[model samples]
Target: MRFLSLAGWLTVVVATAAPPSVELQLQDEAKQLVVRVEGQPAMAYQFGDEFALPHFWPLRSPSEKLLTVQRPDPYPHHRSLWIADKVQMGDGPVVDFYHSWKNLRRPSKPADGFRHFIRHQRFSEMKTEGATALIEIELQWIVDDNRPLLDEHRKLRLVALGNGAYFFDLTWNLQPHEGDVKFLSDGVHYAWPYVRMHPQFSGEQGGVLTNDEGRRGQAGTNDQTARWIDYSNTVAGETEGLALFVYPDDTPPQWLTREYGTFGPRRAEKWSGTKFTLRAGESLHGRVGVFVHRGDAKSGRVAEHYRQYVEDKL
Candidate 1:
């Protein structure tokens, strides 16, 4: 007689399970989002056992626009990619995300070091206790390191987005705000269709973010004390991509300088721009949400959808 134990039968099925065809993402209204960008592929998030920063380190040079640079083995960005089940794949499009100084070719002071300059070399293991995927990031930062940057810790939660959009709930134990943190989108506009700040239309109308107190005719307090800004191009049907930042403790900061397609201090060579500092032993945190959509940031319909997202308290 031929018989099979239930456990053995289950193991057989598991071993023969089909490989994942495409990556997946969605939104979780429950948790506050820390990071979420539209249209990122699974290949973009590969790492070793823990999340490792690949050597590439999504970079942009002076002669060229923003692009992925492949240094030799120990590729920087490759180390950053999260590891899957050893699935080989081709390199995907370049998506620039700066959680540390690595993202910038030249940040403020380039040598003086950044505000509260946190030294982050490792990512906590991806742990799943209940229904959420949790990952904590440790940084080697020095408070009193700069006038505006105070040291702090950061935590991010990757929740399942049954749909095609991902919800990254990031909590920042921030280093105080050194210089103002915003975007320099002149050349960058070529890549991302929509880009804008919160309390402002997404990037569709081409509206830029400036610390123009004069424009605050009737706006609320800059709310510098830990608030968020969201940008997205949408995932499900069609929408706008998002760019937003929040500062807890209302960390004081200065405005950023402009570059062709880049945003940071000392773009060319002459340290030109405001320089804020984060005192030692201080902490701050914020959240950012990105949604890749199929439309512009200011379309009438898109505006309504954005309102819905805000109304839903996302």
Candidate 2:
């Protein structure tokens, strides 16, 4: 069994060597995940993990404890969970559903049929060099249906920097998914207390889309493509991160952008305000980057990091 424990550094001392990835250990008292960046010297807690958005999204029932933090928000964004146990499967320990409240796809019961395991989830990632550290992570997911099972794959990656911040990166690429494309939802959430208290330093913005029904065959509503997301934050650390997307094949209306944070993001007349469709022999992909650094939202130095990521990928 695979278990993901507190994957973070202990002290807040920056390192003096090359950078390497590490894990963060959440300090309940501080109510913040401590990070140690190797190259960044002027920033502590330069980047933080998922600051939960409480009021908007449900604490996800039994999935609360497994989550890191939860606050309230207006609409769209809702809540976020730093998923370390759910998808890890046999990599560490089995999910507890309570204290270790993990979110995963339980075997299908005869009566229920199938459903989406959880909406969108965020996870933490840390990289360090001696005392220095970098904190980064990525949160993503897609609707998983239980109709004969076609094909699917999703991955989350994080990079810790030199100061005491983090950068979490996630990649979600779904292929040959079987089923009718539906609507999508996306919005914003306030980490309520933390964000409300430090509004000038950190927050988030989101966007999503769904597909149509008529086009729900092997060539659903949209086609293959991607986009760019620059993270300008109100926090410490000047070097932020870069994110993008890539869809190699399919149709249009570019369905699948999440506009709301709900169990449903499809083309139905229910919660979501969108719809989409897809079929076999199709592929879709996206990339997003979050740069962790020191400063306010207006002066956040994320452009430089975006350039760095572009060059590194090339």
Candidate 3:
């Protein structure tokens, strides 16, 4: 009897310490990939053709609170979390995939006569290992009707951290498929990947934005170069936040911060506001980490996580 009781107790302890299970579900009809932790959806990747481009929406905190807002008022083009920019293929007109709606013939019908768009071709890979899930997808930068300007390979990895926090790792590889492609995005209008927090988590609603340098709020942090940035707030008596970390690149990055609810790292000065060409067959690469955690930046150990991310520890 004593031995049996001891074994039962050990089983309970091991179960309590076990890491949460992560799962990836592909909903083809919905055109979305839902990532669930322990069977509950933590976030989703929306790639439906109904929109100007693909984006991630409803990024939820550990407490299941929505941390991001999609197409909010004033800036309806700002998808919750996404990447886009202006580009020109050969001598063709510059198409602003970042503000892609301009190429649509009808705002209500995105599939009608869109001239230029980013189309998700297929998912090359999707799998889960232990508490981590990964997705690899192929996409194309399309111009005219069916001409391909660039081929994009994107990978996303989600690691389930205990206590409901998580790490979202993103890597992008863009190769010019046709001729030389010129990136014509200006410094003031772009971010490699933007995060637009929900109104409840915006500075207007008592949230705080802080960078690695201890700069707080939009006025102090806007356009500043930082290794990481965090946004947090207390809502419904619970504190939670999100942080973004940019990997090292040739040109140090600048960021765009807003008090109303937007923040992201911009391309380096050498490329922003100037033409950077990727000759045919050449590729441009980028990587970033999105850390969603409980509590404020300090309490959440945003800096430590960022360091770990840089060292590939997480």
All candidates' TM-scores? 0.37, 0.39, 0.93
- Which ten residues in a row are the worst by lDDT in model 1? 80-89
Ranking by TM-score: 3, 2, 1
Instruction: Please write out the lDDT profile of model 1 over residues 237-293, one tens digit for every residue.
Output: 334333223222234232222211111111111111322223434443344333323
Query: Evaluated with lDDT, which candidate comes out highest?
Result: 3
Superposed by TM-score, candidate 2 places the C-alpha of residue 169 at a distance from the truth, in angstroms, of: 3.3
Candidate 3, 161-212: lDDT as tens digits: 9888899899999999978999888668788888899999999999999999
- Once fitted onto the true fold, the runs of candidate 3 whose alpha carbons sit more than 4 angstroms away are 1-15, 107-113
- Backbone N/Cα/C clashes per model: 77, 108, 0
Q: What lDDT does candidate 2 reach at residue 266?
A: 19
Task: Name the Cα RMSD for model 2.
Answer: 15.6
- Each candidate's lDDT (Cα)? 0.29, 0.29, 0.87
Order the numbered candidates by lDDT, best leading: 3, 1, 2
